[model samples]
Target: MIDAIKTFLVKIKDQGHVLPLIHQADIQVNLHCDQQIIQLNIKNGGILFLQNLDGQQVKYEISGSPTAMKQLFEGTERLRVLEQQGQLKASTPLRTTLLLESIFFLTKAQNS
Candidate 1:
């Protein structure tokens, strides 16, 4: 499923019309696990920091644009809403905090 999602995102980005969405954005996804923060060097400088709280693991995936990513962390209840709305699906206590660190990264990073 991850592979499928990646392929789809890549295709969407390759389309000239959609590419403009993040022409100046970059993203980095940092997975804080194993007692360390794993940093991913996004090619376009886009960064996504995902901190999954212990005891929770998601079954489905929650996806959005860079702007939407930053907004999801406004409060704790918002996370719950995402799950309930089928945006984020997890069986454990997975808490996520998203941060936008650069303007060169976009969905292109993950999609590519």
Candidate 2:
């Protein structure tokens, strides 16, 4: 699962359209799937995936079961929809939530 997440982020990083957005933004996210936690640091025009939080301040924490996470990573589910269905939970401001949704949508489009 962590490998999949890393690969997904690598794809996003390589995307020309997404690169500009990523370069201009600094975001930190903690993804919790079941008992596993993966921290995503998006800053300085690069993305880093870490298994340990290392006391970094997190801007958002998104959590769900492994099944829910798999659905999301597979582009079979949207973050908003999963949250609405109680399959996932995200702690973030509205703006951040929208940003994440957009990122996921863009990734899905790329896969298509």
Candidate 3:
């Protein structure tokens, strides 16, 4: 799952617009799915996944069931919709939400 997230982030970073958007972002985000918790360190226009949750202070938090998380990453579900349905909750600032929205735009599925 962590590998999938890393791939997602890397794919987002490789997109044309994301580099400028995340150029100077230094943020730590904690994602909780099922019983697993991991910290994603964003810096230098890239993300690093840290599995150790020992003493990290996460600036943003998103928690949900594993299935919901998979749906989100697969672009089958939006975070806002999941939150509205009580399947997911996120503790994030407005700026972080905007940043993530932009990043996730790269991963959203296209309708043909």
User: Against the unseen true structure, what C-alpha lDDT does each candidate score?
Assistant: 0.36, 0.75, 0.72
In candidate 3, stretches whose alpha carbon ends up further than 4 angstroms from where it belongs are 109-112
Q: Which stretches of candidate 1 lie over 4 Å from their true place?
A: 30-112
By TM-score, the best candidate is 2
Q: How well is each residue in 1-112 modelled by candidate 3, as lDDT tens digits? A: 5655755765664466666877898877788987889886778877677886787776699898887776665556777778789988889887886676556555653221
lDDT of model 1 at position 47: 26
lDDT of 1 at 66: 32
Task: Give me candidate 2's TM-score against the actual structure.
Answer: 0.81
Give residue 59's error in model 3 in angstroms. Answer: 2.8
C-alpha RMSD values across all candidates: 11.4, 2.3, 2.7
Please give the RMSD of candidate 1 to the true structure: 11.4
Candidate 3 — worst ten consecutive residues by lDDT sum? 103-112
TM-score: model 1 vs. ground truth: 0.31
TM-score of each: 0.31, 0.81, 0.79
lDDT value, residue 112 of candidate 2 = 55
lDDT of 1 by residue, 25-60 (tens): 443344232244333333442323334345444333
